[model samples]
Target chain A: MFLNETQEEVRNTTRNFVNAVIRPAAEALDREERFPSEIYEEMGKLGLFGIAVPEDLGGPGFDTLTYAVVMEELSRGYASIADQCGLVELISTLLVRHGTPEQQKMLPDVMSMKRKVAYCITEPEAGTDVSGIRTTAVKDGDGWVLNGGKIWIHNAPVADTGFVLARTDKEAGNRGMSIFIVDLHAKGVERGPKEHKMGQRASQVGALGFSEVRLGPNALLGEMNRGFHMMMSVLDKGRVGIAALAVGIGQAGLEAAVDYAGTRKQFGKQISEFQGVQWLLADMAKDIEAARLLVYSAAMKIDRGLDATRSCSMAKCFAGDMAVARTADAVQVFGGSGYIRGFEVERLYRDAKITQIYEGTNQIQRMIIARELLRKGATS
Target chain B: MKILVPVKRVVDYNVRVRVRPDGSGVDLNHVKMSMNPFDEIALEEAVRLREKGIATEIVAVSIGVPQAKDTLRTALAMGADRAILVKSGDDVSQDLEPLSVARILAKVVATEKPELVIAGKQAIDNDMNATGQMLAALLGWGQGTFASAVRIDEGSALVTREIDGGLQTIRLKLPAVVTTDLRLNEPRYVALPAIMKAKKKPLEELALADLGVDTRPHLTVVSATEPRQRQAGVKIQSVDELLSKLKNEAGVI
Candidate 1:
C-alpha cells in the first residue's frame, strides 16, 4: 500500500549520516581547497560511494530511486559529493549496461572507494555538443593509442581512472565517437592545473591530456561505432544526478539562511521575527521542496526503467536555476557575512553556477524536452 | 574476547512519535524504526574493538517482532560478526514495562555465552533505562550502566560510567553487561560494502516457542494521547516587546 517504505528509509538514513558526518567537514574542505578526503574515506567505508552497485558487488543493491535518495542526502551535505556520484554512477550506468563482463566487475571496486574515477566528455571545443571532440583514440595492435585532450573533467587529477570520449574516425563524424575507460596513471596521460572554479571548489575539476597514451583492448567501453548513441542515450539519469546536487546546494543555502535569521539579532529582535525575512525564508523552503520533488520524481522513474528523459531534463534545469537564485537570496539573508569566501552560503552561491553549465547544459535540456514533445506530436 | 552487544530497534529519534487522542496505545503502524541511538553507540564500541583486534566475534542480537531483523542488518552493516532475532508477537507490548525485553535478552546471553553484552541506557521512546541492568541481574552477571568509555585489556574491561556530576570508572571481570549513555562516541555510518554484505549476514529468527518464553498480552493501556500543547504566546516585533516576552511572557530571558 505504501509507495515502497524501504526506499524512503534508505533516503532518511543517508540524509542523517551526511548531516552529522559530512556537513561539518564540507566548509572546511572548501575553505582549505583540500579534497574532502576524510568524507570520501568515511563515505567509502559507509558504502556511500557504491549506492547503486549490486549487493553482490559490494553495493547496497539499491534501485534507481534508492540511488537517487542516497545522492540527494549526500548532496544535501555538499554538492561536491553529487558531482562524484554523477561521474561514478550516472555515466557509469551506460558502461554497466553495455560494458563487457570484465568492465562490469570493475564497478564494485570503484564503489568500494578503494579506487577513484573521473569523467571527461567536455572539451574546450565541445561543451554542450559532444560531437566536436578532437580527442582521438586510434586502434593499435589489440589496443588503442589515445591523443588530443579534454578539459572541464570532474576529478581529473586525483582519479585513477576515467571515461574519456574521443573521436575514432574523422570521416564518420558523430559515428566516429567512442568512449574509452583510460587509466589516468598511464604514461603519456597528464593532468592539467586545477580550474579556477566559481563554486564547488571541494570537487577537483580540471583538464586531462593524452599524448598517444596506450590503452588495453578492454578499454573500449561499449560498441565502437555506437559511441555517439552511447553518450546520448537520453543522458536523463545524469541530469537527475546533477539536479539532486543543485537541490543540495539550495537546501544548504536555505538552512543557512533560516539558521542565521533565527539567531542574528537586528534592532534587538531576531531577524526571523520580521515578516519580510519570514516571507523570503518561506519562498526558499518552498523552492527547495518543489525542486526536491521534481528531482526525486525523475530518479524514481529511472528506478522503474521508464522513459523519464523529459522529466529528468526539467528537474535538472529547474534545480540548477533554483540553486543559483536561492543561493543569491541566501547571501542576501546573511548580508555582509555571506559575501566572504568561507561562509557556506558564499560557497553555495559560487558552487551553484556550474550545475547549469555542466551535464549537457540547461539550454540543451530545453532542446531535449522540446524534441521529446515534438516526437510525441504533443506540440502544435 | 567475544563480545555480545544487544542492539534494540526503537522508533527513529528524528521522527516525532504521534500518539492517538483518547486511544488505547501509541500508534505504531507505519512508524519509522531505527537502532536505538544509545544502543548504536554500544554497537559502535563493540565493532571498534573487534576492528582493532582487541576482540573477536562481536555477536549482535535484538528482541522484538520478526522485523527486528532490520536492526540486525544495521549491526551487521556496522561490522558486527553476526546477529540473532528473538521474535515475539504483538503481545510483546504487554510485557510489564522493561521485564519482557530484559527477559528475552537474558535468554540470548545464556545461549551465546559471550564475555560482554553492551546495551543502551535507554531507548529514546520509552526511556525506561531498565533492560540492561535487569538482563544482567537475570543472568547473574555484573552490570555497568551509562558507560561513556569502555576499554578492554587482558581479561578485564575498564568502563567509565557518566553520572550527573562527573564520571566513575570500574574494573569488571568477563561476562559483564554495559549500558551506554548519550556521551559515548558518535556511531559510524555503515559503509557501502557492509550494507551489501549485511544482507548476506546470518540472521536467525526465533519465535517465542523457540526461546521458551510466552509472548502474551498481560498489560493494556487505558488511553493514548499526545503531549500537551503549549499556550500561544503574544507576537513580538519591537526590541522592547522581544525583551518583555523573553523575561515576563516566556520567563527565560
Candidate 2:
C-alpha cells in the first residue's frame, strides 16, 4: 500500500506498455504459439529487465517490490510474456549476486534481451528432489564436460545461454552439485522438440540435451559443490515472482467474471443479480486481495534484505491455489461461453493452471512452508 | 539558443470526468492528474530541437499548485534540462486561468530571456486556447498557433500551422511563441531509468509574489453544468414517416 513514487511510476509504465503493446498481440501469439521476440526486445529497451538490478550494472536498481509489480502488470496482459521476464530476472539476479567479473559482463545483453538464458535445474528424473539430478559436469582439461539432459526447461528452444546445475561430485548428494553457464549453441548440445502444453503456449518450452558439452573454466557460476544452496536462494525470489504471476492471473479472471456476469442475461436478468453468482464473485475478490497482500509482503521482505524463504513459499502456495480456483470459478461465471475459445477467460483458465504446477508445484510449496513452520515454531 | 516550454497538469485523458452535482465544477478528488497531452507534444518538439543541436538549453515552466511539481518532473524526465514551478497556492483557483498563466509566464520570459517559447495550443481542462497568444502579446513578439511543424535557422523560425481552411506557414523572429497542435509529433515513453535520473535535475519553485505578477481572474465561471443528455431515437416506419418527422418534429425540411 505504501509503494513509493518510483515504484508507482514503474507500475504505471509497465501497465501502459502492457495495454498498448502486449494485449493486442497476446491472443495471436497464443494462437500461433509464437514467441513475441520484438516485444521482449522492446521491453529490454524500456529497461523493464533492469528493474531489480543496480543502476551501474545497466539496470534501474529497483527493489524486489518493483520487480513484483512489473511481473503482475505484465502478466495481466499475458502470462507467457511475464514468464519470460521472470526467467530473465531469475538469471540476472543470480549473476548480479554471485557471478564473477567475466560472468557479470553478460548483464547488459541479458537485460536487453539480446541474449536469453534459461534456468536448468529440473532434469528428467529430478522434479522435486534436487539430489536426484544426474546431470554430471565432470572436470575435463581446463574445462568441464556436461553429459545429462534437463526437461521442462522454460525458454530452452530460444535460449542462448543456460544457468545449469550439474553433479560435480557424485558422493556429496545435493551438495555435490555445481552450477555452470552453458552455451546452448555449443557442440554436443541438442534441443529436443518443443513440449506441447495446455496453456502458456506462447512460451518456448523444451528439453535440452548435453552430450559432453564442453564449458570453459570461467563458465562455473557461484561455487562448485554449492549450486544447491545458490539455487535454493534463487528459488526463494522465484517463488515471489510466481506469486505475483498468480495474482495477475487471478485478477484477470475476477475482472472477466464480473464483466461477463454483469452483461450476460440468464433467467430474465443479468446473472450478476443472482445470490450464487454474487457469492462466487465476492469470494474470488476476497481471495485475490489476500493473495496480493501475501505476495507483496514477501516481496517487501526480500527488498528489505530480510530472509523470505518461508513467506515466499506461503505466498506462492496461496496465490497459486487462488489462481487455479478463481479461474475455474470465472469459467463457471461465463457458463457455456467460458468453455469456448475466443473468450479471454477461456485462455486465462488454461494459463492459470500452470501457476500451481510449475515453480515448485503447490505441493512442494506446502512442504517448504510446513518445514519452515516446524523449524521456527510458528513465529507468525 | 534557449527554449522555454510551459506545461499544465490536467486530468488524465483516460479518466471519465464527472461534473459536480452542485454545479460548482468537475470533481477532482482522488482523480489521476497528468501532463496535458498537447504539452507533451510541445515538449517533444523542444526536446527534438535540443537533440538536433539547434537549441543549447531547454527550460520547462509550470504554473499551478504545489502538486504541479510532478508535471514538471515528468518534463525533466522527458529530457528538459531544468524546470521552474510558479506556485499559485491552493486557494487561488482563478490564478490558473489562461490570462493569469500568461502573465506569470511573461514574467518568466522576461527574466529567463529564452529565444523561443513553446506551449500547448490549449489545456485539456479549460480548452481556452489563449495562453500562447497572450504571452506573445504581453512580450510584444510574433506568435504561431496550432503549429504542426517548426524549422529554425539563425534568428528566424518557420512554423507550419494547421488552420480551418488548410495549412498556413509563418516566419517569426528569433524570440517567438509557438503552440503545438495534435499532429506536431509523438512523445516518447519516459523510461524508469530516465525518471530516476530526472530526480537529480534542477527543479526550482517560486511563488507568484516573487515573480511580481498579479494572478487575479480575468474570467468567471458563474456556474458549471453538464451537457444535456440526448433522448433515445425512434425508428421510422417508412420514407413518408421520415419526411413527416423531419418536417414537423425536427424542422429540418
Query: Native contacts retained per candidate?
Result: 0.53, 0.53
Give the docking tier of candidate 1. acceptable
Query: Could you tell me which residue pairs clash in candidate 1?
Result: A45-B191, A46-B190, A46-B191, A46-B192, A47-B191, A47-B192, A199-A350, A199-A351, A200-A351
DockQ of every candidate structure: 0.37, 0.62
Task: Looking at model 2, give its docking quality level.
Answer: medium
Q: Native contact fraction of candidate 2?
A: 0.53
lDDT of 1: 0.80
Q: On a 0 to 1 TM-score scale, where does candidate 1 land against the true structure?
A: 0.81
Best by TM-score: 2
lDDT of 1 by residue, A1-380 (tens): 22354564466567778878778877887776667766676666566765666655556667666666677677778788767766778545675677788887778667655578887788888888777889998889999999988887888868888888889888998999888988899999999998767667778888999998999989998989678888777377778878888888888899899999998999989999999889888888999888888888888788778788888998999999998999899999999999997788988898899989888789988898899898876632
Model 2: interface root-mean-square deviation in Å: 1.2
Chain A TM-scores, one per candidate?
Answer: 0.94, 0.97
- What's the residue-level lDDT of B243 in candidate 1? 87
List ranges where model 2 is wrong by over 4 Å: A258-278, B91-95, B228-253
Q: What's the lDDT for candidate 2?
A: 0.89
